[model samples]
Target chain A: MATSHTTEAVNLPSAVQERQRRAKFRRNMFYLALLAVGLVAPFVAYPVFLMKILCFALFACAFNLLLGYAGLLSFGHAAFLATGGYVTGYLLASYPGLTPELGILAGTAMATLLGALFGVLSIRRQGIYFAMVTLALAQLMFFVFVQSSFTGGEDGLHGVPRGSLFGVIDISSNLAMYYFVFAVFVFGFAVIQRTVHSPFGQVLKAIRENEPRAISLGYNVDAYKLLAFVLSAALAGLAGSTKTVVFQLASLTDAHWHMSGEVILMTLLGGVGTLLGPLMGAGLVVSLQHLLAQSPLGNWVSVILGIIFVVCVLSFRSGIIGELSKMYRKNFK
Target chain B: MTMIFGVPMAVFMGQLTLGLVNGAFYALLSLGLAVIFGLLKIVNFAHGAQYMLGAFAALLGFRYLGINYWLALILVPLVVGGFGMLMERFLLRRIAHLDHLYGLLLTFGLALIFEGTLINFFGVSGARYATPEILQGGLNLGFMFLPTYRAWVLVAALAMCLFTWFMIERTRLGAYLRAGTENSQLMQAFGVNVPLLITLTYGFGVGLAAFAGVLAAPLYPVSPTMGSSLLIVVFAVVVIGGMGSILGAILTGLGMGIIEGLTKVYYPEASNTVIFLVMILVLMLRPAGLFGKEA
Candidate 1:
């Protein structure tokens, strides 16, 4: 009797089933296209530049995963970024005979661990309280890094070598390094996309839209939040580790609370929930900085960035990709 | 004549006095933050920049107008408060209906603009503003040497905090302000000028920061970077004390300041971060903060 009931449930109208299947395939194709672009774009851009973009894109994406999807704003994301950067820099620069791969892993591991620790303490509060808790925790980490001898105290850890990737590939070459970063970014991006589309992601969205309803449905809301937080932190660490490798140095700037604000700005500038938004946002921000390097307006970057944040928050809540997606959806539908 | 807890009495007294001086600024700044946050529901990230602006205003007054310390104390807050009013009128008023986070983002933008402008005009090395000759000397406390200016600062800040507290917590006008803070719509129905009150509340809060700036000018070297450094510490203060009650803000500020000073005497390395450490401990024990209400 149970088997017959299950079979009946599975047997749906063919047209409705076909539409669902086509939608699933389209989403998968979108992911594949994104992966392909992330992989190929490095060759077109400067390798180092590409690496920077990937790392920040990953960071912004991780940040959006929390704020956009989970409906939590974390003001202290630099804690994870700094932890990852410090771990990688310390290992590559201080320890002898460490491969780049191992260094990256070490950084990612530290960030993951720290993220879990913070997530437990932070998820207790909602909205503004959550933001404040994160900021306070991150500020604590900043002080620790500033005072610790290993971080080189204010002067920062300098002269880090771009060690060989697993003692084989020389990451010194621009093209070679680009491909390595591209591969890592794609891996991270794919994981995020998968996680977001899974049953877990659906639960997260439900919680974001209306927590009481999600709770009423017998979901362990807090646990879902914690899981999302850890994932976001680990991805952010990946970005930070990649950045350390690309820059060949780790400094106080990486750990400074201002960097946390900058990441939020990047996520906001890009459409928050859109997959392509962070990538485009990262590209825009990084390229802006690159251009600003030669111009007199260089000093005003923070001001301009801040203005963009205010404007985006006030007027363009959906962000660039979000707006674009709306047009696309209207036309296609 | 004797030592207590194996520490010299003179040294202990000195630390206590120093703690009081630091506490004065803490109380003043946190009070301003609480007022601003209470009414606006925004943290005002640019507060530090405005505090710095207050110091700069004093410095400018001294440089060009030959204004003395006392005159600047009165004039600067008015000036800074007026500037704050203008900011509210032009920028902040436009985004009041949106999420409060927009306020933070906008203020953050203004902070960058102000800081960047100051940096462009006056280099990052920082400039100095000297204490006026009248308040230059120290007082003989018998147990410890107390600078007259420092003592004055403590007393002045205490008075100002209390006066502001009394104004907001006691008076009829304060009741209206409190009512507006609680429910602007209800207050509007009662025929209160809610929007005007908001602009003034913001001005009053910014003016409080400027007032602290005047108090701080004599103790710390006047610099553009001063406010940001102090602002972060004040944020930690707000987190620990919780912005729930004005009394809580004042007490926690003073208490944390003393704790920080004592830490300096024992373990100087942790002194810089003891407030943050205490904040973490507070979060662990009581996430609602010592006096904050659950949102």
Candidate 2:
């Protein structure tokens, strides 16, 4: 009787499981189509603008990896981004022989180290305290960069070399640079996707849902959180490093707490946990900023962004992609 | 000409006083933060912006309305506090049930909006508020000369902090506020207007920040970005003090300021970072903060 009951319970949701599987397959196909469109996007759109969106998209995705899945809200992500940018920028500018990929890797490594240190210090605190700790640490980094001459103080590290990739492809051309950025974004995106699907990601989600339960289940919750934070930071660094190569400059703007706020805004606007949400959000925000820069409303962008933030928090907490997916599921199912 | 730590005694005393003055602002701001956090469970990221508003309001009062310093002092907090109440009633009330972080994000956005608007109107160069005629000069305190306005700021901030502490810890209204903080639903069931209390508490907390801002107008340039720069340091102060205790916040704010002042004297380069360093240390030693109860 017990064996039969177990069999019945296991078989009860086969149809629902099958439907979910089908939906997931459809979603994967949709993502592939989106990728194909992105591959051809430079021909149709401004390569420079597309590159900007891709960089910020990667940054936002990295941030979402921690916040959406691991339940950690780091208010100091700009530090990682800045570290990555500055390291890569300094390396490329000072050493013309350094390959772009190597410089980017070095920057990412630096960010990973910084993230581990920050994570170790901050992960002990929960919630708001954690946020404050990260912010303070980031502020400390900001001051260091400001005081240090290597960062060029207020002027920033400029004229960073867009060195050849792997000593083969010249990425100095806008189109080439755009493609390179797209490739890096895809790699970063895939890494995030893989991480999310891994056993580790499942554990992180479990921790996010209920930390105490996860702890009771014998998972070292702090270790998982730290690993996630480091991974996110490294990815954010990668994005920043790539941005410096693309823009041929790394400035204080990348390091500012305001930049941190911007990433959070992008991630929120796109859809925190949804795979494509950050990309969409980053694209919209970058486009909005770009368009506003040319318009008389340039000064009003902050106000507009603020309004969007308030509106999002009050009504659309699920964000753009999140809302769309919810509706799609509701209507289709 | 006496030397202390290889620096002139006067210089040491001046820095100490300057530290105290800075501490007063820290105390006032952190007190407001602590009070609001106690009840709202939301870090009022806009507190700094509101403080900036207070300074700007004072400047505008003088510029447009011909209101002098004393009157602006009285008027600014009320205006800013009323704005805070409206924010609570209209905006914050909506997110009351959401995660605490949403409130923080909302206020952060509000801060950006307010700062941006202020920049558009006032320009980033900043404006000057004259030291009130009555408090313009300095008094020689034998060892060090003290600016009268600075002295007033210190005394006034301390008085306000004490008054807030007394009201919250000693009075019947304080009792109601504290009870609501403990359990708002229970307080509501017991016939206390918990929602109104929350609104008033937020308003009062914001008013405290404005009060500090008004006090600071003469000392610092009345600029849009002034508050955002100081806000991060005050956040460090809050973390070091722990958000749980009012007195702890006040004490930590004051102590950190003094420490920062001393750092300026001994290691000038480290002054800007001493508070954060202390914060890291505090987090290491006491993660809950010096006076905070374990979560």
Candidate 3:
């Protein structure tokens, strides 16, 4: 708007600003394209499968918020996820008149509380100890789930009616459910996007890069880490809650250590630090699992998963999106 | 029969012994974890898988190759420790220079591979290994009857834990390991082969897990998942004890196991979660762990 008038006022580094603007433009374009793809995805493929991917994708993204940005690798994130699912399932099953959204909200809230508990205990330790503490705490929760009558024990908390959204929109239909999940995914994704780009995210990144340095720079390192951990757990819970609503079941598998491990694989395999990396990772892993589960090689899915983990850690450390973005930055940027 | 806490004394004592036996397994497993972590700075996530391998190895050998329980005890550790050494040299060594979490991740993958392959071959229904004739039958007490094999497990685990403690705390080889842990570069400058020591340390640490597995084979079903499940509880024990002190791991393991067993008699429901509850309490009071120095 002021191309000529403001130009002579100061050397504004307009070229650098222009480059940043172009980058933002390209990023927005990519987002719009992705959103467009997501919109038509249910029509092109099965709605149920798309919803599953979206739920887990949000989960991976939530997990990435901790491990990638905050540099806190929680080995028990499944605790939060399962907490959300079970709470939602229980509430829905108990309150026949309760709306689906409220049950999901309740689940997410419980998960956030769990995240706080998990963070308070495990955040004290660093590196390997932190992972171990988280895993231990989650196992504790797993036992609770196993013994609790609310969980229905080995049979799992089942027969959860999807009900109507807000008692208004009947979302039990597959397409309706897909859209509902998509909306929830977008909201969660938006929250993550905002958090990552905000100044808080910058500080979290700093802490991840160098905690001592961040501490020296006056950041409350524990508080930051705890906040990040809680946020990640809450989002993971949200994913789990939505998943239960979609599937109408909450099983013990949701809270198992393997679930925790699977989330890490998704984040690592997709790209640790990148924005869209987890989504891509979740998509691939979920699809791979689905395909393998249906095939004769189904029994060996875990072996393949382990092989993927070894390969990722040993060689593909940057993951699919990480490498792709690296190339894009090198060439396109 | 006398009643203690409103339960039959025999049942109470039986549960206590069972708890203590479980604790022995915990002590053995966590001791290996502590030893390995001391040198590698990596939590061997697959230690549980290795323990499972030990059980399967012993069981399969017995079933097909006529390997006796005693023979399996001696052989399984060597075989599993050899496997651990190879893992260190190849998969683990590659990521040694990266973040310690990568090592955890790699081991976790290896754990999955071992667990997955085992479960694939032998479905979840576990196989049983009869206690050897030498340890068969039961010991009659005034209260509960104690299985001879169970008593032997307690004895063997005690000997193993004490021997490990002595080897690490009182011996010259342990001195080298301690020195290496303190500063590998300094140890290397002192003409000790640090890398070789590291490899051996990992092997020995994992050998402890294998020993526990072989010991466990007769007690529990020779299932693929037995180790992975118990591994988490040991992790709790490690967190409660802190990961540094071998003695701490042993004591905490036994104590937690006993507490768990008592809980089974008293509340029944909380037995599975009691150790974790203690862990939470410990984390709140002493973030460094009960035995860990404040970091």
Output the number of the TM-score-best candidate: 2
Model 1, A12-55: lDDT tens digits are 88887788789899988987887787677766767777788888
lDDT string for model 3 (B42-104, tens) is 999999999999999999999999999999999999999999999999889988999999999
The whole-model C-alpha lDDT of candidate 2 against the native structure comes to: 0.91
The TM-score of candidate 3 is 0.97
Q: Lowest-lDDT window of 10 residues in candidate 2 chain B?
A: B286-295
Evaluated on chain B only, what are the TM-scores of all the candidate structures, in order?
Answer: 0.96, 0.98, 0.98
Q: Which stretches of candidate 3 lie over 4 Å from their true place?
A: A1-12, A331-333
Candidate 3 lDDT over A1-333, as tens digits, reads 244435643555879778767889988999999999999999999999999999999999999999999988889989999999999999999999999999999999999999998898899888888898899899989999998999999999888999999899999899999999999999999999999987789889999999899999888999989999999999999999999999999999999999999999999999998889899999999999999999999999999999999999999898999998789879975
lDDT of each: 0.85, 0.91, 0.93
Off by over 4 Å in 1: A1-27, A330-332, B1-4
- Least accurate stretch of 10 residues (summed lDDT) in model 2 chain A? A1-10
Ranking by TM-score: 2, 3, 1
What is the two-chain DockQ of model 1? 0.53
TM-score of chain A of each: 0.93, 0.95, 0.96
Q: What DockQ does each prediction reach against the true complex?
A: 0.53, 0.81, 0.86
Q: A249 in model 3: Cα distance from truth in Å?
A: 1.4
The alpha-carbon lDDT assigned to residue B166 of candidate 2 equals 99
On a 0 to 1 TM-score scale, where does candidate 2 land against the true structure?
A: 0.97
Clashing pairs in 2: none
